[model samples]
Target chain A: LAKTTQPISMDSYEGQEVNITCSHNNIATNDYITWYQQFPSQGPRFIIQGYKTKVTNEVASLFIPADRKSSTLSLPRVSLSDTAVYYCLVAGGSYIPTFGRGTSLIVHP
Target chain B: GAGVSQSPRYKVAKRGQDVALRCDPISGHVSLFWYQQALGQGPEFLTYFQNEAQLDKSGLPSDRFFAERPEGSVSTLKIQRTQQEDSAVYLCASSPPLAGASNEQFFGPGTRLTVL
Candidate 1:
């Protein structure tokens, strides 16, 4: 399993865009980057995933550079309700997913 | 269609008592996992089951913790002689068979256990 490093917390204002970056220097060739959002007392929900390049979904977008050692999760037009903890994981092939101390995003009014 | 579900959303156990937590995974999900989350910390993997087989249990903290998935659908995690350190939220997640790919895991609300 590859270890990931991300910001402990971030602050954003409503209607503003937010980007959280994760670093996985030991990422493997077969690994895929995934991001999850977790609300208070709730399970982590899948936000976006990508292997390389960019992948966009209805909720968020994921950008992966060519090296695949780092990935970014971009959330457009943040809202107060969007405040939550975000987790980034690198897993694939036979690797089991692991969650690190996620980045806590606080969307201020 | 229902997602994963767990019973007894909250449990308060006295020290030295035994407790059991139940999890009902999403229908047709082939992979089931158990995780323990302490307050102010990220979740930690506990065990995993592929169908009726327990593929990995190396994450289990101690021998006192046991988990079983008999029919490959519902699972039960039992803890014997609960201690204060056992107080945490137990999360259950299920995912479809990936066939060597990475799949999104659907999680339950988790069982909050407080040992007093």
Candidate 2:
């Protein structure tokens, strides 16, 4: 399992675009980037995932550079409800995934 | 279909007491996982079970913590002699068959355990 590093906290206004970046310099060949969002008292919800380049979904977008050293999660038109702790995980096929202290994004109205 | 579900949304135990947390995975799911989340921290993997077989428990904090998934469906995590540090949220997650490690994992609302 590769270790992940992300900002401790970020603040964004409603209707703005928020990008959270994660760094995993030791990412392996089979490692994939996944993002999850957790609100207070709720389980973390899957947001987006990507292996390389960009992957977009109805909720968010994930961008991975060619080096795979880092990844970014983009949330567009954010609302106050989007305020939550976002986790970036790098995992491979073996099923062992580790989570670090995530980035807490505060979306203010 | 219903997503994962957990029992005892909140539990408060005196120090040294035992507590059991339950998790019900989605129907027909093949993988179940237990995680511990401290306040302001992300969920930490505690154990994993592929069906009824507990494949990995290396993340379990100590022998006091035990988990079992019998019949490959409902799973239970038991904590013995709970300490203040054990006061955290226990999360249960399940993934569909053939889902990759990075695949979406359905999570339950979680069991909030408070050890006083």
* lDDT for predicted candidate 2 compared with the true structure: 0.92
- Candidate 2 clashing pairs? none
Please report the candidate that would top DockQ against the real structure: 2
Error of 1 at A102 (Å): 0.4
Q: Please state the CAPRI-style docking class of candidate 1.
A: medium
Error of 1 at B79 (Å): 0.8
Q: Per-prediction TM-score, please?
A: 0.98, 0.97
lDDT of 2 by residue, A1-109 (tens): 7999999999999999999999999998998898999999999899988899999999999999999999999999999999999999998765877789999999888
Score candidate 2 by TM-score against the native: 0.97
Q: What is the per-residue lDDT of model 2 for residues B80-106, given as tens digits with 9 covering 90 to 100? A: 999999999999999999755777898
Question: What do the candidate models score in CA lDDT, each in turn?
Answer: 0.91, 0.92
Counting clashing residue pairs in each candidate, in order, gives 0, 0
* lDDT tens digits by residue: candidate 1, B1-116: 58999988999999999999999999899999899999978888899899989998988999999999999999999999999999999999999876232788898999999999
